[model samples]
Target: MSAQHAAPAAQPLRPARAPTGSGAIGFVGPVLAVLTIALGLVLVRDALAVAGVISGDGWVVTVLDAMNGQTRTGWALAGGIVAALLGLWLIVVALRRRRRKALWLRKAAGVGIRPRDVARLARVAADDVDGVLDAKVTAGRRNVNVDVRTTGDPYTRDRVREVVTARLAALAKPPKVSVRARPSSSTSGGMT
Candidate 1:
């Protein structure tokens, strides 16, 4: 007699996430690291001086003397304020989400699309309309603004919206499409 084995449970897949760029941490982290290293190096130098392995009063002694000798001044206050502001800025940057570099597409879980590429796709769709002479598209995460130059056909705007909407159907959360149609300058015999 053969023993029966039980099947393992299936785990649901996690939703796809768009890329959030490095943001301020990318710049601030290195600066902070360098400052820390410099401080460590200075402390080591000061230790060497204290041990009679180097010359001079050392930075720590000089700083301590200066702090003990001087009263709080406007410059010191200003520096403190500047440092506080820097800390606040760092907190804001660290806590806030980084800017998204691409948008998710419904075509596939691994697929992503950039705003510029979305604009290009919308422009191509707008241009496919019968009377459209030119198309310009500006795309964001939730909006696609289309400006079309057409052969003075009023219906061109509707056609552009329809075509662009259909083209962007594959997007997981498709942006709202706005189409503005204008008469083509070339067709209107305007200045070159």
Candidate 2:
């Protein structure tokens, strides 16, 4: 007698696409800083001009003098104070944002988790359950994937997979669990 087997199914391939430009608003902060600096300079110039510190030859000087002596100094001081405040505020905001970005980058790089740390986490996860003869685990991005080899009993294998997944998930992020079992010489339990 001859036996025929069907060919395996083909899987669809997913293509990678380039990232979108939606995050372009990140440039607005620097643009705003430049505008703030320019406005500050204009305010300082007008203030100095009204106080007779600069030559009153321009239209800005004429407008300042037209508002009366008292109003002119008030306007100049107000403008100077607003400009100074804006400039200082912008600098403080930029520095704070820079520090936050640096902190986020350091955390993403796993802070102080070296190769030895990973190996230790994997070893601890492997030694969790009964029939778990051997296990291997690796972490990526924010998730962990573990592979387990079990002795014989189906219940023990399932229990090991569940316990390891739970323990690793608690310590790390959510983990994906995969179990491969070798058939025993005698069938003591059924596979679920």
lDDT per residue as tens, model 1, 46-140? 99999899988789999899799687799999999999998889778766778887878886885788999999999988988899998889999
Per-residue lDDT over 109-190 for candidate 2, one digit per residue giving the tens place of the 0 to 100 score: 3323433344346557665777667666665434445565567656765675676566544332343555555434346554
lDDT of predicted model 2: 0.55
Question: Which 10-residue window in model 2 sums to the lowest lDDT?
Answer: 98-107
Give model 1 RMSD, 1 decimal.
4.0
Error of 1 at 38 (Å): 2.4
In model 2, which regions exceed 4 Å deviation? 1-119, 183-192
The local distance difference test score of each candidate is 0.86, 0.55
Cα deviation of 19, candidate 1, in Å:
2.8
Each prediction's TM-score against the native? 0.79, 0.31
Model 1: lDDT to the true structure = 0.86
Give me the candidate number with maximum lDDT. 1
